[model samples]
Target: MTATHTYDVAVSWIGDRGTGTSGYRAYDRAHDVDAPGRPTIAGSADPAFRGDPARWNPEQLLVASVSQCHLLWYLHLCSAAGVVVTAYADAAVGTMVETADGGGHFTEVLLRPRVTVSEPGMVAAAVALHAAAHEKCFIANSVNFPVRHAPTVTAGA
Candidate 1:
């Protein structure tokens, strides 16, 4: 049997400075995320001395979401298959392009996963599990952007 879960992020526009520093808040189903004076966003400071904080940016979030999804599924699959995963990390990236509506949206995301396996021969199993995780990842399957996984695994380290 297949199982499913759901979540939501609600954002509200507090105000705007016309150029930037526009205020906004992201709320989970529970409540708004607490942060500093201004809601955290990626590229907060530009070279010209403007807010451009990239950590909280949508592009970053897209990459992070893909990374998280793959990691979650990897652990789940490994547990179910009796494979012990020692550690997992990913450097993910996303590309944004102008949409037909003259607004930019993330079009592609890449998940570069570096995974560690607890035993030899399990690397192969872990590699195979990467593909399975990609197939089963809910976020990857749910989003319109192209989500790709590039995995590298090491055994007994």
Candidate 2:
């Protein structure tokens, strides 16, 4: 049998403005996402939907999840392959198109990862691991949109 995993979180809306959602723009879109032994994440709709800009949105979270998944897998593969990564950062961007029916879907997400390796010879190996990591990323596999990577690897010393 294949291994199985389950994730659970509770979402509580705290946007009631006394009168509640009586009309458009009547209430805030603020909410909280909580899981066991983890800090609560403040969440809201995208600012286009009258959500607070300071809070995390579902679309942004989706992109973050994909980026994080790839990062973790890349690091693990690098460690096992003796690539000796010194640093890694990704500036991931996602684009979505809004429909006339007031719905939207992501078009694509670009993962721009900059990586530093301990040795010059490891640069190529580090760069190659991104493709392998992308293939193993669960979040990327689940999303319908294209998840592209623009990775740059350099030797740190």
Model number with the top TM-score = 2
Question: After aligning candidate 1 to the native by TM-score, how far in Å is the CA of 104 from where it should be?
Answer: 3.0
Off by over 4 Å in 1: 1-8, 15-51, 99-101
Candidate 2 segments whose C-alpha is farther than 4 A from its true place: none
Locate the minimum summed-lDDT window of 10 residues in model 1.
24-33
- Each model's lDDT comes to 0.71, 0.95
Q: Judged by lDDT, which candidate is best?
A: 2
Tens-place lDDT per residue, model 1, 1-157, is 9777555444544324454433333211111233445563323322222334422444456677788988998999999998899988898888777678856667888888888889987888888998899999878998887887788999875
Write candidate 2's Cα lDDT for 1-157 as tens digits.
8899999999999999998989987899999999999999999999988999999999999999999999999999999999999899999999999999988899999999999999998988898999999999999999999999999999996
User: RMSD per prediction, one decimal?
Assistant: 6.6, 0.8
